[model samples]
Target: MSTILVTGGTGNLGALVVTRLRDQGHEVRVLSRHSPEFPVDLRDGSGLDAAMAGAEVVVHCASSPRGGDEQAAGHLIRAARRSGTVAHVVYISIVGVDVVPLGYYETKLRVERLLEGSGLGFTILRTTQFHDLVAEVVDRVAKLPVALLPKGVRVQPIAVEEVADRLAELAVAAPAGRVADMGGPEIRTLEEWGRSYLAARGRGRRVVPVPLAGKAYGGFRRGGNLTPSRAVGRTTFAEFLERRG
Candidate 1:
C-alpha cells in the first residue's frame, strides 16, 4: 500500500476520496485546517512539509473560488518536490475553466497550468458542476417569490461521489496529464434546473430567466462549460433530488 496525502480531505469531495483510498488499503493522510493529525492550511503552506513526508501520491482537492487557489497549488507543488517521494499529483478542476471568463474559473485555469509546468508527474481531471452546488444555487435563487436565473446558461451537474471515485482512481494510477472531461448524463438550462428544484421542494416560486450581460455569462450560454460527449455520469438531477428527499 502506498502512502498518499489528500488536501482538503474534510471537504465534500475530498472526504469521499480519502474514504475510497483508505478502503483500497492505501495509507491516506488528510491535510486540512481542521484535521487533528495534519492541520495544514494550503494558502500559506504551513505544516505541509510534515504532511508531505513519505507520501507517494498527492490528491489535490483543496480549492477556493474566492481566490488564493494558485498560491495554494504553488505551495503544494513546492512541498511535494521537497519531499522527493511524491510521484503523482492529481488535481480536480472545472470543465469550462479554459473557456470561461469568470474570475474563479480563471484561477482554476492558472492552477492547471501551474501543475503542467511543475515538472512533477501530474494528472488533471476536469468535471462539470457538482449536484450539491447546483442545488444550492437553485435553492438560493428560489428563496424569493421569483427565482432569477441566467437566460441561456446551461449546466451539467454531476454527482460528487462519481467525481470522488474518478479522483481516487487517478490518485493511484500512472500520471496522464489532462485526462478527458467528465460530465453529467444530461445537459439542461439553469432555468429548467431551477424549476425542477422548486417542484421537488414543493415551492411555488416562479423561475424567471434574466439576460445577464457579461463575458462569463456569454461563455456559459454558449455551453463552454458542458461536455456532452463525456456524459458518463449516471445520476440525473431528478434522481439526486429524489435521493436527497
Candidate 2:
C-alpha cells in the first residue's frame, strides 16, 4: 500500500477521498489548515514539507471561494516539488473555471495553470457543481416567498461521492494530466433546479429568474459549466434530494 496525502481532508469531497483511499488499503494522511487532527495548512509552506515527505501521491482538494485558490495550490505544488518525494498531484477543480469570470472560478483556473506549469506529474479533474451546493442554494431561497435565481444559468450537479470515487481512482492510476470533465446525468437551468427542489420539499414558491450581467452569467448561459456529452454520473438531482430526506 502506498502513502497517500489528501489536502482538505475535512471537507465534503476530501473526507470521501480519504475514506476511499483508506478502504483501498493505502495509508492516508489528512491535511487542512483548520483541522487540528492533520493541522497542515496548504495556503503556505507551513507543515507542508512534513506532509509531502514519504508520500507517494498527493490528492489536492483544498480550495477557497473567498479567493486565493491559486496561492494555496501553488504553495502545495512548490512544497511537493521541493520535497521531491511525491509521485503525482491530483487537483479537484470546477468545470467552467476556464471561461467563467466569477472570482472563485477565475481563481480555480489559475490553480490549474499552476499545476500544469509546475512540471510535476499531475491530473486535474474538472467537475461540475456538487449536488449539495445546488441543494443549499435552493433550500435558502425556497424559504422565501419568491425564489430568486440567475436567469439562463444552467448547471449539471453531480454527487460528491461519485466525484470522490473518480478522484481516488485517478490517485491510484498513472497520471493522465488533464482528464475529461465530469458532470451530472442531466442538464438543468437554475430555475428548473430550484423548482424541482421545492416540489420535492412540498413547498410552494415563485421561481423568479433574474437576468444577470457580467461574463460569469454569460459563461453559464452559454453552457460553459456543462459537459453534455460527458454526463457519466448515475445520481440525478431528484435522486439526490430523496437521499437527503
Index of the highest-lDDT prediction: 1
The local distance difference test score of each candidate is: 0.94, 0.88
Model 2 stretches with alpha carbons more than 4 Å out: 34-37
Query: Per-residue CA lDDT of candidate 1, range 28-87, in tens?
Result: 999988878888988899999999989999999988878899999999999999998999
Name the TM-score of candidate 1: 0.98
Per-structure clash totals for the candidates: 0, 0
The TM-score leader among the candidates is 1
Writing each residue's lDDT as its tens digit, candidate 2 over 1-245 gives 89999988888999999999999999999987665646776666688887778888999887778876777887888888888788799999988887877888888888888888998899999999999999899888777789999998888999999999999999999888999989999888999999998899888898999998887788889998898888999999989999989
lDDT of 1: 0.94
Output the worst ten-in-a-row residue range by lDDT, candidate 1: 32-41
